[model samples]
Target chain A: MTLLAGHPTKVGRLAFVDQDYPIVLPVNFRVHRGSVVFRSDTGSKYMAAAMGQKVAFEVDDVDEAWQEGWSVLIQGMCHEITDPHQLKLIDGIGLNAWAGANMHTLEILHHRITGRRIV
Target chain B: MTLLAGHPTKVGRLAFVDQDYPIVLPVNFRVHRGSVVFRSDTGSKYMAAAMGQKVAFEVDDVDEAWQEGWSVLIQGMCHEITDPHQLKLIDGIGLNAWAGANMHTLEILHHRITGRRIV
Candidate 1:
């Protein structure tokens, strides 16, 4: 499967560009209508992910017992969402923002999502 | 502290440029000589991280009960290690490669490693 199937944490990462260097951050994200969404604050990661910047999101899981795992890499354009209507949609998903009561939602959309599993 | 003091996993991520779109991948990595190292195969992620590519590596952890967490972002250059002496040193570090005897070690070195913890 091009996407992870039947996995629990659904944890992914966000990567953006800052002064010719790439910055990577681990984020708790969810899949929404073929798009990846997460929560961020006015931090360095959030700042670098200015609207329209090319970015990436990745998710992976490892089964220690089985000694096998799968990884998915998603490359897309970063979009900041401030629409109340859209925010309401993601609010229902219940994100573990870990930020004290003030978090902003961001989304990344791409044409294709790629994944690989070593079984 | 910019680095995780007591987090057990010590896992980080690697981000690289793949034809203009950044690609992020979660990897079980370790910090050595102030550098981030991980095991990779001859895959897309490995291919793109050839020689000296400006990349980023990150690590983060969350305590669900504490409702707080910390994240570290590392930006650096990707260097592939084929030297037997270096490979032997990394092998002694005990990495859970999860690959079938054919994985290669790659290291990303950076001048500065940055992290933030939300309490």
Candidate 2:
């Protein structure tokens, strides 16, 4: 979660299978209670989450010149936060989607989190 | 391809279906003849490529302060460059995996490429 918080871009890629092929999309996200929280319209992402699909969220920082970096991968089942209480709570967390408005909240229930750091 | 070249980190996330779940792993890569090329050992990635699985590779640049960025997504079939001639040609392209030794060459045969930029 600290890595997610400290990412300079505050951006990560959300990976999920769509139409029999894996797809990764860049999303502005926040870490909430050890899970990844982000907003999106009722698009493919929301649909995927609604289906409780397993996903991988990845964030990394690399120094090209030095050839060193650290990466964190979170593998979990995605759930659309539909409960009113949870939705209100997440709204108060101050995570706004980088694009679009009236977005739906989605969370990746972190099942396995791993990190690799190279120096 | 231009975005891949100009990315400061020269890194991107490779997404593929692994064990019924989507997994995304960060990889150091370079563009060669409009395809993303990188090196890897006989790991899950190399195995996935050897199977010719469909994959998604994503790269992005974001400015937290300005709340803007551009993202490129490449949907393709992963292929291990087993042909010695192609391997030699890609080796000459000068992309080294960020870590490890005696890596195998992998390429994503471009099927579809898309990008979005928010200014």
Candidate 3:
């Protein structure tokens, strides 16, 4: 899948099933090659990463008045990045960490990365 | 645990662990009592529901320049609303389904609904 060009300017949203119901959240992300990466501290997202499963990422912009906007969806498998060497590489890229939490632990998940661009 | 007051005009984001990494998505939602609800078609979110697990839901608003906004986070167990009776109740509430897809099946999942409001 193609990463949206020019600094990947899109909001990242994630949807996963929790006990038969769906829970969704929005995140800031940086896309590279074939993986989508973001940072997180000890939380539910961390717990899910510990479980190891496939997940969904959706990004979109909509204007209610115009009834128009574009959305990009990425569906793939993700794996956490734990190797210190890899972590350092991610940090080197200098992505904006806007979550305002200490994500020093740095978990990187990669999705198979298929996307649909809808306008 | 409390639902954000008044029609819950916040963006819903879901974060889940996929194969040792975290994936996040943004969604539209309605909150009532102690649960958060939304609709979906057959997708990854549906698969996660079928697995029966807890998930995370985050809602926030941020104005970059002001560096200020409020975020509400809900972490809990979710169960799909499969019973026809409950399904009808959800439809009756008339929450706006803005996803623009045929969510006629109406799968409702309830989170334990704990939230932190950060401004």
Over all chains combined, what TM-score does candidate 1 have?
0.83
Candidate 2: give the clashing pairs. Answer: none
lDDT against the true structure, per candidate, is 0.69, 0.79, 0.52
Tens digits of lDDT, candidate 2, B13-68: 89887776677888889888778988886664435543578899888887756778
How far residue A51's Cα lies from its native spot in candidate 2, in Å, is 4.5
Best by lDDT: 2
Q: Rank the candidates by lDDT, best first.
A: 2, 1, 3
| Predicted structure 1: clash tally | 0
lDDT string for model 1 (A13-116, tens) is 77778778887766667666567777776664454445588887777776644667777877778877789998988888766665555467778868568777
Q: lDDT by residue for model 3 over A30-70, one digit each (tens)?
A: 66544667665445553364334445777656443343455
Stretches off by above 4 angstroms in model 2 are A43-51, A83-89, B43-50
Complex DockQ per candidate: 0.64, 0.71, 0.23
Model 3 chain A worst lDDT window (10 residues): A1-10
TM-score of chain A of each: 0.81, 0.86, 0.68
Q: How well is candidate 3 docked (DockQ)?
A: 0.23
- Model 3 stretches astray by more than 4 angstroms: A1-10, A14-26, A40-56, A64-94, A101-109, A117-119, B1-11, B14-26, B32-34, B41-56, B64-67, B75-94, B101-111, B117-119
